[model samples]
Target: MLKIYRNTSIFIFLVIIGVQWGFYKNYTSEFPNFIGKTNIIHIHGALLMSWLVLLIVQPLLIKTGRTQLHRTIGKVSYVLGPLIIIFLFLIGKGSYWRAIGKVPEHDILRDMVLDSRGLISFAIFWALAMLYRKDAASHMRYMIATGILAIGPGVGRGLINSFGLGIGTALTVTDLIALAIVGFLLGYDIYKKKNYKPFLVVFIVFLIGAFLWQVRDSDTWQSFAKSYASMFY
Candidate 1:
């Protein structure tokens, strides 16, 4: 089970990197427009990549018996985690502003709500992981949940960009992927440890998020989003 966890962490990290790269490829031509500017997009990307690197390295450290170094580096997440959420909010706000007049109303609303839900889930799982850091089993489960939450936006983007899927379909695909990952982890816990509490918590939170994502462009949500976006503009 330990070996499975370590290998799965590495696999997830690689998949995240690949999916993000695919998503970015869609915007490669516009990269130069923001190259010199100090933009929220760049900050968000850097912070997220840093977190993903830490996720990959932490597991490898454990696999190789470098617990001291792993613990030392884990301290960085104390700062990194919150910064990621902050930058994510900024990115979402910036995106909303940029699209207000040009993009379709439904598209903007959907994107904003999806981004918000991902950030919320990431924060919840990260806080849980921090609270249970001393319990290696529970801590790692929470951390993996965080990773799953974080990858959702990238998965949606990859689906839209690579497969030319509609926004609704892309988001549905992303949620399904997230649900499958959580289910696999929950099954592992039940099989090996007879403990599914943490995974169950994450799964429930994710399902709620998935539900919200599916209805983000509804009239009620659009009204809420317009009210929220008015604050920044």
Candidate 2:
């Protein structure tokens, strides 16, 4: 099991950073002289990227037999985790508001569903990972799930920016990729006769999120979204 996770986080980190760099190549091209970049955006990027960095570092510490160092670094998530949730919500809300009138209402609402789903899924997985911190196997799996959730946005952006795919199609492709990854992990765990519940739960969440847009036309969702945004966003 440890071998299975040895470099998995590194692979996830690279994929996430690669997709994000490709997707936002234009913005990143500006480099140190990033004009028009807001502080919120900077903070948001820092928070998320830091979490990914931690994921990479933590596994390495363990692999090096530095268990104490790994535990110390893991504690950083106590502060980092909540900051991530807050900023992710802020960034998503900011984008939604900024897109008003500029982007179509249907598209905006659909995007919101996908964004909120990812946010909810990340929070759930993170919480579970922390809750199961004593159980190394479960804890690592849930943490991996959170990393998998982060991939969706980067992949969506990559699909759109690299291939000029429409937002809907890009998002759909991202969902498919995420589901496939989780499905493969779940199958592997089952085959090994290991506990598969964690991956199974994450797979269900992603599946629901993939098909969630089908309910965007319902009045209840629209009303709730607007109300929630008005209060929190």
Candidate 3:
């Protein structure tokens, strides 16, 4: 189970990197623009990548019977997790400011709301994983849920750029991908442990969050988002 998740994390990390590269074209002519972003972008990217690398390493440590090392390294998330949330906010706010007139109002609202939900989900799952640190099953499951939550933007971007899907369609596809992952986890729990409580909770949270994201462009949400953006921008 641990090995499966570890490998899955690796695959997700690769996918995220590929999506980022594709969307930003940072490796090509856009490298200067990408590297010249405000310090917040650099910090956010570094912390996020560090977290992903830690996720991949922690499981490998456990699989190799280096429990002590794993625990030691796991402590890093206490700092990295919060930093990730903070930087996510900063990045999102920066994006909102930059898109004020250039991007459509509906698209901006949708992105802000979806980004907020992802941040909330990450914080919740990270806290739960910490609280259940002693319970390997619950802890690992929460961690995996966090990973899934963190990948939404990447998945959405991949869908948009790779398939030429519209933002709305891409977001819907990402939501389905999240549902499928939770469904698989639920099935695994049912088959192996005869208990799916953890994944059930995750599924509910994910569904609600995705729904909120889908409706971000509603009149009520748009009003709120405008007010919120005004405060920051």
Candidate 4:
């Protein structure tokens, strides 16, 4: 079990880089000039980045035998985690408002499904991680799952902006990458005879998200998404 978590920091660091690399073309490239961006974007970026940093450092702390410090940071996440989720919803709300009348119903429906499912998945993973805090193996796996979840938005956007893939293609590729990571983890867990349920659960959640994306154009989803968006301010 300890062996499985030993490389968590390295994996999370790579994910951090992937996220930044994805966002750079459109978001970070502007750098100091963040002129037109809203407060929610800045706040969400700060909170999400902080969570990523915490995710990376927490594992390193445990690996280095700084269990006390790891616990301290874990406690901090009691506040930090919910804030990140709230900001995610706010960002989604902002997206809905901004895209209304500007994009087609299909686009709006798809975006909402992606946004809502991502939020729900992240919340589920984080909550389960918190609940399993006493179970190091489960906790660590779920924490790692959150980092995987975080990478999708930036990476998907990067694919669109940098590779010129259409939004649909970029999103599909991003979902594939996420599932690939989860699949590798699940497979390795099985090979090592470790508990594979954590990654299996994450994989199922992600698959559901991907499935929703595939069928987001359906009238049922479109109507639900419209109603979901209306729930926000």
Q: What is the C-alpha RMSD of each candidate to the true structure, in Å?
A: 2.4, 2.0, 2.6, 1.5
Error of 4 at 38 (Å): 0.3
Relative to the true structure, candidate 2 reaches a TM of: 0.91
Q: What is the C-alpha lDDT of each candidate?
A: 0.80, 0.81, 0.78, 0.86
Candidate 2 stretches greater than 4 Å from native: 214-220
Tens-digit lDDT track for model 4 on 158-196?
788777898888888888999999999999999999999
Model 1 misplaced stretches (Cα beyond 4 Å): 28-38, 104-106, 231-233
lDDT of 2: 0.81
Q: Write the per-residue lDDT of candidate 1 for residues 10-61, one digit (tens) a residue.
A: 7767667755755575554467674433467777878877887788888888
Ranking the candidates on lDDT from highest down gives 4, 2, 1, 3
Model 4 lDDT, residue 130, Cα: 96
- lDDT of residue 88 for candidate 1: 72
True-structure lDDT of candidate 4:
0.86
**What residue pairs clash in candidate 2, if any at all?**
none
Give the number of the best model, judged by lDDT: 4
Model 3 CA deviation exceeding 4 Å by range? 5-29, 32-36, 104-106, 230-233
Report the lDDT tens digits of candidate 3 across residue range 96-172.
87888999987897778876777778888888889989988888878878777755677677667677888778788
Question: TM-scores, in order shown?
Answer: 0.89, 0.91, 0.87, 0.95
